[model samples]
Target chain A: MIAPFKTSYLQDMALTKTPLAKASYAGLLIALAAIPLVTGEFYVGELGGLFIFAIAGVGLMLLTGYTGLVSLGHAAFLGIGAYAHAIMLAQGVPFLVSLPLAGLITAAFGIAIGVPTLRMSGLYLAISTLAFGSIIGTVLQKWDKLTGGFDGFPVRPPTILGMKVQGAIGTYYTSLIVLVLVIWVALNILRAPLGRAMVAIRDSEISAQSMGINLAVTKSIAFGISAGITGLAGGLYAHYVRHLAPDSFDILLSIQLVTIVFIGGLGSMHGAIFGAVFMRLLPQAIAMVRDDLPFGLGRTPGLEPSLFGLILVLVIMFEPGGINGRWVKLKHWCKAFPLHRRAASRRQKSYAKSERLR
Target chain B: MESLVGLLQLVINGAATGCIYGLIALGFVLIYKATEMVNFAQGEIMMLGGFAAYTFVGKFGMNYWVGSGLAILATAAFGYLLDAVVLRRVIGQPQFAVVMLTLGLAFIFRAGAGIAWGYDSVAFVTPFTNSIVKFGSGVVLGADNLSIIFGTLVLCGVLYLFFSRTRLGIAMQASSQNQLAAYYMGIPVRRVFSLIWAISAGVAAVAAILLVPVQMVDVNSGIVGFKAFAAAVLGGFGSIPGALVGGVVVGVVEQLAGFYLPTGFQEVTSNIVLLAVLILRPQGLFGQVIRKRV
Candidate 1:
């Protein structure tokens, strides 16, 4: 992965360091594009769900991973976006317009929630977000006229350029396009000075402030952008699913999104994609092998959740760096094959470890 | 006079429910005091305890008291094992990771309970039958409500005595204040940590037992833990007495909101109070203000 010496500043600041990396990335994009054509209808739908989750995962990574803000209310924002998009579409608004508008509305809500809670950090902030999420959930259930109450409401499939985006393939492409655009935006943000500011704040708010970074502005902006991105994903999800229920975006979904970020590898943009794909495919994999297993374990009501919980615990205990961390290590080890030094191939300390009790 | 009586009834019911919240909040405070880690699984632990008691009394045909006692002991053992096996390894990990781990554990516990005891809601049998006791001109209290209030009071008093007068409790407090220093002084810090988890789990079991008698036992009963969490935060996360006061406050506010406001406000009332307290007064009523240091 090491790159040749760059003669110019532009070359040094390039997204991909080497031509091999660039070619591989291009190949990945083409492979992703061809997935809908080659895969079955069922898999196309799964990929749609994957892309939606990836969008949300990337959003969460920006806040929790880079900005060091833990939010248990992400699903609430998603709920807001889903409802907003649905409402707008019902009113004859275009899909493209409704998507960004839903994002903007969710961003406003995010800022409103963030402004009050951002002053606090760690567990307190997490609890506050949890409270906010529950409150939003309650609102979604009670506001019957707007949200259709517990029964939920129908979401009309989105149309593009006067043609209906029909079926699983259509939705998959729409989600894929959105996912690609979001990834691009996210990558650019990370490369920018603002991303560095966020990382600095995450590392040490006090030191970041001493360095003249506005804590309030940076944190609030992060919250808004994160919520906006998650909201867009929600908009996409609503159209894809063609239905909306308050229960669909509960605290469990929020937990799942966070799990995606963590299992993929926190603070890495690519981790979101890897985590989302793995998590989305996991239940399907289980379902495929469920009948073969002895004792009918897969038929249990909470089996999937229990498995997810076990995975989360295992990941945190053994691989705090997650799947991406393992990938990086594997690459390093492979590069130094035959003389691979475990110590030398270890990942740099990027994440903040908790302080031991005095 | 009838309206006044209705209000009093609501207040009484609120207090009873609040006591249950206080019991759960007390678990949060105990663990936080010892380790500064919020056990997100506290509610799920409560739910499992209730299921355990149900299985003992209903399925095994055991006496109510015996079943309750067994449930508490079992949950305590589970808690100890949880801390010793899983949580001990995560001692110096980030707060976010620990919190998420507890959340994951909560999911596992809830799912396990659901699988073991079907998702159906079953009436929990208590020794005392449901009876209404009239007081003064119009105030009437359910026997169950009175028992819950009194039981919580007794538990709190016992806990207070344990922390103040017992040797092991004092040792736990010493370890919580300074683990390394306590270790230097020959206290078993790791053992203390496990004991705290056990005590917290046991308290959660008591809350669940009391709760199941009032309503019914179901897999989703752990949702009450979220309200208790709010109560813990509202009262001051690490303060024992604050948990009680906070629980009462949240319960009363929730009942009043449900009574006076539009329908469905009750569900969100505790969260609203939680958010308000967290934003307006992060230190809480009893919590000491934490000053930031460079």
Candidate 2:
């Protein structure tokens, strides 16, 4: 049954999805493991923040991109996660134990609040989440006893294994490890029955339900998983910044996360990476421009949002599939241009023959 | 009873706030109803209108009456231009694209205003600054609040009349109800849409004019878009009366929540109200419960 193109599993020699793929993936992992060893503290610190944001973005990609749930309020979960961690650290709880607990708590909280998501879709869901986010932000400011109000609460760095882990390198490695684990979990989820169920749910809730997929459970689990991931990111953010403020979890950050998921490409892991890196780097890039540009452009902070908004709009209008999608399409077209043209002509000929038969 | 007077005041305040919400929601509904696009820019438009009016009188040395009129017209024109230049091009895109585009527009408008004007909040002086009317008991209505209530009433009344009585408004309404059917009936659907866009913009300007008196004029004033959006949802997205009721409910709830709730609970309360409404009655108070068929 093997055709010329189908030479067993050996012929399926893609860079991913095989034993060879695992080896290459492991090799890539080793290289990444060595990145902090050679990189400067400033670069590692920035990358650390980017990694944290990417983890949050991955959660969003699962929820919004894959499950088709629109949340303009994931930042609130991040805030919740951060506060959980901050509160824990303030009480002298070790960071290692607190982080996972924060994530679990966030997941539970997400499911509790996401109850409305079972019935609502689109704008209703968006508004519902947006409202929740705004409320969290306000409470973070107003709940002085717990959140420490707008000025924010201080967090001490966690000591681990009798070693004082202070500095950007430790933070970067911590963030990097978390990001790798998140990526691994996300990849596994994408491949699992639950992941396919999410995609099916996204594509058609009615069809999935008719196929005996429990809508409520699936949706709630997706929300929970997404929130847990975001919470992990949040805990990291709190520890990294060493401060937790209400303003840190405003609606704008939610929008920023949404923008990253969209611009990175919906439903693609690579897109999440692309989006996180670009979004993090873009501001710094703009800041670089500000530093280097002539006097007129100097010392301006408002330009960043405007430019960001402009890019977001442009991307939505011109590139609905995002950077990853565009890149994939480009590569595909480049690799098969000639064969695609010949096949198109052949298909047209067959179509004409079929039309005559009809 | 004095309680009756307080209830009346709450009702008055709610309705007045509802008027502003309705007007702003009218911006969302106008665009959504006609083109199936939710204009996140509506809130920013309100901010711009408020800021424009503030500047005209405060900075440009224009009279209050002139500034108010000019601000409305200018913002209406800006709305029309946005429709023509940007929104129209994005027709037939995914609803998400349209939504995010407007969201981006909101950021641009708010931040742009911030850049143009400093981040500091400024007071907007309405023409009826110091006027007050004493109710029979101790309840006194500030002239500013009274003007807002009366002005919104007049605007809404006129809008209702325009939609029902005027031919152009009727055409716009028909278009919003069903574009294909209206077009088949030989209505200039696109023109009516443009007109609605203009009218909605004008309505937002009216809301800005009314609201600026009470709230500080700043980039944050645009955040009222969500409050107004909540009002729209509470009332019913497409229903005029629903928009009014929704806005008032949101405003009064906000006020009451502010007054009675814990120090920082007002913000959370509004969202809780919205979530409750959605879970309990997603169709909203006055909205038609649409059932889709496969």
Candidate 3:
């Protein structure tokens, strides 16, 4: 009876309002697909760069946003995946087999770390992950034969489906396809019982345990799943960049991933995509301005990180929920129109309280 | 006989290095006690402290003692300003917010230092008497090592006295233990926090000064701060003596592991040791083990 009743027109525009909203999602997908056609090699490569980070950001959202595990060593899993892919390639394994194997290996490593560290909470867990990243990078640098040491190893592009997969377009297509598939899997996982358990733990681990969730098993599995996704991204990144170095997978990269996920708004898949694009493109956009602007200071090489830090500080201080959150407010305003002003006034107090808690 | 001598030398050197780690970890512990937050910029603060001293002595042609003292003072002031401006607003925020803020601070400080001092590593002259002392079976220790060990010991002794015997230190300790109760008791919680930042910065400067003699100074020197953080966790969070033991354990483990482990594992010895400590006994050697009521 409720499904057959007519809904108010205003309610239809909100996310998850109806099946019609999802049907319109196809339009957005089409627009993304058409981007490569109009964009040149360099620009497509740039978008591909965003996709690489988006893949990892998705998993981090699962861990930090949904699973309540703050990982500061996610780059280690990425490194593992990249190195695993490289090692497999050197052994002449096919790309199809190598990528999945890399994910599996990273998942196992994650489980190994998670099982031992399941008892830790909050800051301890974060630092442990940071340690993992540091150790992994250091080992990669020292293991000369396997990782090619400090000089790093050059990766050959994977050949697939009788086509010699190479260059910007090939890599972009591969990345896009993989990202879409991974996202579908992530959404499915999020809707499952395990996903609800992860969220329950995030909201209140004690409560989750009280309700009969096996805390240790759930935490480890979440970690393993997240690591596996991160590994997939890393494998793609190595192939696309065609180079792997210890410096490429530093603690800073892990920190960056966490920051991007935060800036996009945690626990939202759309937020992950939004965050990935913003982070990857921000520096590039700044560099573009530097090239165009007449200022001498703009030409400096190391300014990117400083600028990134400044932007991050500003975002954290002023807009904790990030761009996606802003979009949500904007959409709400557009739909509410004349009533928006009164609604926003009532929201301010509650919003401030929530922000403080976060 | 030669191997025994080698082991002795390694232990002495490790102890000296551990002293520096302990000093840095002390900075971390102090800040955590005051703010209940990790200062990721602790290492960068140490780097800036070293660079400040370097600039004063090398560029300004000042006496070493005067330059070092001035640099320490400057770093302490900087630390206070950092807390006042950035950390104050996030007082009740989640731990991740503080972590991110410190991470950002670290990048800013590191990049700013890179610009000011240039990226290349530079040599720093220690003010200590640069003499090497030889012991039995060809074992040797440097004067700089002696200074570091002595300096850290003296600092710890002074801190112990200050915390236990002085009004301000005791009040600060009370504030860290429970801010609400401390406030009710008429302790100025905010003032104690600012003082904690100042002291942590001062200690970091001392660590930086001591460390310069052992390794060449650069932007990366701040990484020693991260190692110190690991040392702090290994010893047990909020435990002063534990920080000391943890630092020494990490330093010795690193030195010995580098020597004994296959060459591939040498560079990672510090991190591996930290991960092992975290996985096994995270409460640390001197830390009071805690169990959740739930």
Candidate 4:
């Protein structure tokens, strides 16, 4: 790894100061920008969904990874954002205005739940969010007058200056633009004092408090920001899917979001994007190979969930560093290929501390 | 008088369902108190127990009582293996890892059961089935409901005696209080933790067996675990009696709400109660306040 030798503070804090890093990022974006023009409609739609999930994953990673607060109910936030955006559109609000409005509303929800639950331990926070998610889901279903209940809600594409933002290509570009904006915002936030405070609270709450950080305020803000970003994704999601069902936001979806933050890696931004890619592509992979498997495993009703479960269990147990960690190690290995030693870059010895006493 | 009988009957039935929830909560409390790890798969384990009982009694034509006893034993063994093989490795990891791990296991267990016993609801005949006990001239109660209550009481009494009187149970308690100290005191802390899991799984099996005459066992029956979780939190996470009491309270409230309120209220009663309890008194009714040590 190249050691940073910065002459100024701003240079050190810059998101990507190295020319190598800059060139690569610019290249990646250009490739993504080019995908819609060359790829088929099917790929555009699938990639669009990947971008949406990536948005939510980045949001969740901010909370669970940087803030050390795990949320099992993010699907509820996604649903609320989608429904709110759709409802506002139904009232003739412009699409551009409603998207950000939906995000703000979901952020309010995050802060509301965060204020109370953040006072407890992480375990309790997890449980409380689970309940909160289920409660919102039920409310959505039973309040048929607003959410349309079991019948589901239909979403109409937004018109931006007489140009209808519908179809696969439009949604793909919309989500990709939002994803880039989110990543940029997240990068800026991480370099600010609020991000430092969040990381401090995550590392050690007591020490963070001793250092004059308002634990509660910082935590709630982190949750609010995370939820707000997910809500933005949800607003985009409504246009992508064209229909919203209450059942779609159940525990399974919540678990899947957690899987993204977890399997992607806990503390890295690239992990979030990588995880979203993996999650969105897995079903397609399964579908492609459905008829070729030796056993009848492909035709099993619950095979997908079970496989997701197995992967989750295996990942947590064997590779807590996740896909991003592996990428880092591989790069390190390749850099020292001629004189590489496995022992030099092996997984660090983890010290597991008990959460019970502290 | 007839209306009073109806209310009493509802209470009785609610208490029975509550008793089942209590048993499940008790399992959660026992495991949590001992190992400090919450098992999200407790309901799935209970579902497995019911399927086991069905296999023995329904398929093999074994005697009902013997089949149930065997099922409990087998499930308890599975619980022991579950800890030694899978859960033990994740020790010292973050709490969220355990949560996700157990959740994954729950999904696996559900799919496993579905493959073994199809998705359809299934039940076998038990002694309590179709039996009714008359209470004076106005009230009638099903034997299955009575059996559930009776079974819970007997089980609790047995557990109380075992914990207070047995040496192994004392060792289990020692390990739970302080793992390092218990290890220094010649206790096998890991084995005690595994045994605690075994006891918890066994308790879940008993609940499943008692529930058979009242309701059929299916792949979806594991959703009851979520309700039991509410009960555990309501009673205080570490308190044994509190779990059972919290469960019964949630149960009765659910029944009352179903009878008096709109139809949709019943499905969400436990979750609502859970949220309410966490907001109002995070420590729970019988929980001891614990301060984190630096």
Best by TM-score: 4
Q: Candidate 4 on B1-294: residue-level lDDT in tens?
A: 878888888888988999989899999899888877889899999999999999999889999999999999999999999999999988877777888899999999998898889889999999999999997786899999999999999999999999989999899889888888999999999999999999999999999999999999999898899889889999999999998899888888889889999988898999899888988998899988877655
TM-score of chain A for the candidates in order shown: 0.93, 0.87, 0.88, 0.95
- Candidate 2 per-residue C-alpha lDDT over B1-294 given as tens digits, one digit per residue, 9 for 90 to 100: 787777667766666666777679878877777777779889889988888888887788788889989999998888888888787766755456677889988888877888787678876566777777887668877766788778877887888898899888888888877677899999987777777788888889888888776677888788778877787777767787788777778877877777666766766666787878887888799987666544
How much of the real interface does each model capture, measured as fnat?
A: 0.64, 0.45, 0.43, 0.66
- Model 1: how far residue B292 lies from native, Å: 5.9
Clashing pairs in 4: none
Tell me the tens digit of each residue's lDDT in model 3 across A82-165.
999988987889888999899999999899888777776667777778888888888788777889988888897887866888
Which segments of candidate 1 are over 4 A away from where they belong? Answer: A1-13, A345-358, B292-294
Model 1 agreement with the true structure over A201-317: per-residue lDDT tens digits: 888777898999999889999999999999999998897778898887889888999999889988888789889988998898998999887776778888888888989999988
What is the per-residue lDDT of model 4 for residues A316-349, given as tens digits with 9 covering 90 to 100? 8888878987787777679878877877656556
TM-score for all predictions?
0.94, 0.89, 0.91, 0.97
Ranking by lDDT: 4, 1, 3, 2
Q: Best-fitting candidate, measured by DockQ?
A: 4
Interface quality of candidate 1 as DockQ: 0.51
Expressed as tens digits, the lDDT of each residue in A57-85 for candidate 2 is: 99999988899887888999999999998
Model 2 stretches astray by more than 4 angstroms: A1-27, A90-94, A159-164, A291-295, A333-358, B1-15, B117-125, B136-138
lDDT of 2 at B24: 91
Alpha carbon lDDT of residue B255, candidate 4? 90
- Whole-model lDDT, candidate 1? 0.87
In angstroms, how far off is B133's CA in candidate 2?
Answer: 2.4
Better of 2 and 4 by lDDT: 4
DockQ by candidate, in order: 0.51, 0.33, 0.38, 0.68
